[model samples]
Target: MHDPKKLEEGFGDLANEQQLVKEQDHTRNFDGDEKEDSRIGTNQPMEQNQDEQSRQQQTTAVTSKPKNKRIATLDAFRGLTVVLMILVDDAGLAYPRIDHSPWNGCTLADFVMPFFLFIVGVAIALALKRIPKVDAAVRKIILRTLKLFFWGLVLQGGYSHAPSNLSYGVDMKFIRWCGILQRIALVYMIVALIETFTTKLRPTTISPGFFSIFPAYKWQWLGGFISFLIYMVTIFTLYVPDWSFVEHHSDGSKRYTVKCGMRGHFGPACNAVGYVDRQVWGVNHLYSQPVWSRLKACTYSSPATGPLREDAPTWCRAPFEPEGLLSSISAILSGTIGIHYGHILIHFKGHTERLKHWVSMGLGLIILAIILHLTDAIPINKQLYSFSYVCFTAGAAGIVFSGFYILIDIWGLRKPFLFLEWIGMNAMLVFVMAAQGIFAAFINGWYYEDPDNNLVNWILQHVFIDVWKSERVGTLLYVIFAEIVFWAVVSGILHKLRIYWKL
Candidate 1:
């Protein structure tokens, strides 16, 4: 009999309490599920992004590493050429075999120019691999040609009488216009233009076959053939008449006459090459010291250069530029041949394939040269820039380049040639400083007693000549140590500091 209202109130309170408990539990479970789902959703994408980033980084590293790597073989080959240049230039007076031939035949020094041109072709192939526009390529080519031409004029244009005479200056009227670099500029311009124009014709995928590569480079080959044919026709067919030149000796000025009214004569004076140079560039503007002066017919001493013979030919004193216009025309073939090799390098991926192609082409050239030279169809003459000479030298260059590829790029034997590679890296700088006598001229500017007694002479006289007690031995050793080794060290330092002087 307690109160009915109180019992009813108690029942309502219990029901309300049970409903509140259920609501609290449901809210707690729902919040936990939401948090767990949120974490899973966020973590899945983050892990996936990390994996993708890792893959991209690996791909980039694998692909870009090759592009960044330097072609050690090519550099080594160029460096070897530079070394040979220094050796021949400095030691040639002592060793005639390594020196340039008087007129006809080949020597160690004869290969320098052709080798340089070949390398220029190779470089062009690499540099203009992906030209975006034609006008841009032309502009760049012209600019480079002008720079190279200017430098050639300054360096080899008789402006500086270096290593022998401290005087420096030249008469503009009698300035020499043709030289090594000038020839290089010409070859570079022509070959580069040929390549630039033919870029669009290159096949997207290289096909398989022995003669497959030739079809791709047919245009360049055709250009080369036309140039060669022109040279051949002009050299053989052009008529050369009597030419005369004036010689200015210390005693007085004297005029000499060369008796030549003929065609197809490869003699020093009568050749169409010299006649063209004299006619176009003028006698005074040609190279004053011609290699013909060293010929046995002109000089008292046959192999070694000395006083002229009493019965020396009239053309002995005549000015004849070796890098004349006609000879340079023939040089285009060398550049074109080099471009072919560069194509192999560009297209071939495997080391074996590249070596095989290079070796085969080299052998073919050598065989062709042998046939032409042996048959006397075309003599191997450097001064004339004969076709046989071009083929022989270019072939040798290819074989040598392949050897370097094997030793450095494949076998990983680079430490021994590191000095050469360094010089190759800064070849233009080395050419200017060491080969062109600029460094000698600079050192010669600072003398102790007089200009004759300079650091360069002192080093040669004391450190080398006096010590060795033999002129030839001392001269060779001095060149090897002072010029080659010294330049090598300079180039190495520059490479370490990343200071490259490109033209």
Candidate 2:
């Protein structure tokens, strides 16, 4: 088997090479200062103090190898997020907790997408330090950005009409303009540009007797803050449009739609976010799976009777994607938070300091989320990409990332989750394949169709569901197990061969 170090050459080299450059720069600064001090004929005590400082800086500079190396925790975190994304996307409707919240709250499913974007932010920040040439780097970023957008369109943008008629691809009415990967691409481009110009990740020598509060990427912090402010202002003011929904009377006579505000508007069609999507993309272009409506109906006596009691009003049937255009602004802010963590990882040397910074970031964001929620400034609505939603999820991500870092990097307990590192390494490929039905298609071709139709169902029905007498629990376990095995085999093979798919 190839060494893991050889496989991580891309990210590791950036970190390692930058550490050397930083050390060289620090040495030059110290020596230059020492020579100037000697020429000035400073007192003997001052000379001794300068020499002591230089020695200390050199020692600190040389302690870079371990600190600068690739963080296993980050890769593991990415891998974990990828796996959960695949799971939820593949079979989340069976479980409400794994599915997205109906409207105003978040679920475990919502975290996966934001986490992926956050990891992208972390990666771009680290990658920028290695690619110093602006032109080459910008070109690469642009190309990758375009590719991600194109792939998203290819995978998710097919017309709703079948090719039996000639109106399929030609109709713009059925085309979905925004989707998961598309949103990710947009967020990455925005955050990457900001980090490239505004943020610096190299460690700086602290002056004697001066404790610094800001990390190397303090400019990034400012940028993120500005973005948050813009997001909030838009949410509060611009979102609440005075659009009306047309209502039809029992006699079939139509009346101008009722105009609603933020206070009354709630679900897919009524809310400001959904209204924007409807105006831009039309209802046909939005996500059609109205899970909340169906769940609401299940509680009633009828399964397939009148339309499932919708969470939204009668005007809207199609659900608006959480990854829609309006919410993408907050998505960028979430990614910015991730970039902040990457800065912390590279700049802080002490384990305690790093841990404290991570905890503080998480707590601060959580507190801000609470304040926004309490004031009703912006409710924690995933559909709206509300300010509180971004804060809460980003804060949770920080706490989770910190915990993984401590467990894997600080304590050296990394071996158990190395499989996740492989998944993380090829996370995008796995995700694209899973999302595009490539994995399902491959599995279906080989697996048998038995008592429950497909092999997975057959296995579940025979092994678990039939015995347990609970289709939900059995099917859930089967899907989870199958997803694990699918990714494990794919990731394991790629890991063994050192073959990674990167854009």
Question: Stretches of candidate 1 above 4 Å error?
Answer: 1-66
Candidate 2 per-residue C-alpha lDDT over 106-219 given as tens digits, one digit per residue, 9 for 90 to 100: 778878877877776666655554434445455656776788888677666764222112233524655777877788888878877766555245445533321363544567
Q: Give each model a TM-score.
A: 0.87, 0.75
lDDT of 1 by residue, 149-261 (tens): 88888888889677677788999988999998899888888888888888899776688987898998899899999989989999999999987888998999999898988
The clash number for model 2 is: 2
Candidate 1 accuracy as lDDT: 0.79
In TM-score terms, candidate 1 sits at: 0.87
Question: Residue 410's C-alpha lDDT in candidate 2?
Answer: 89
Once all C-alphas are superposed, what RMSD does model 2 give against the true structure?
9.7
Off by over 4 Å in 2: 1-68, 159-172, 199-218, 239-268, 290-307, 310-312, 445-457
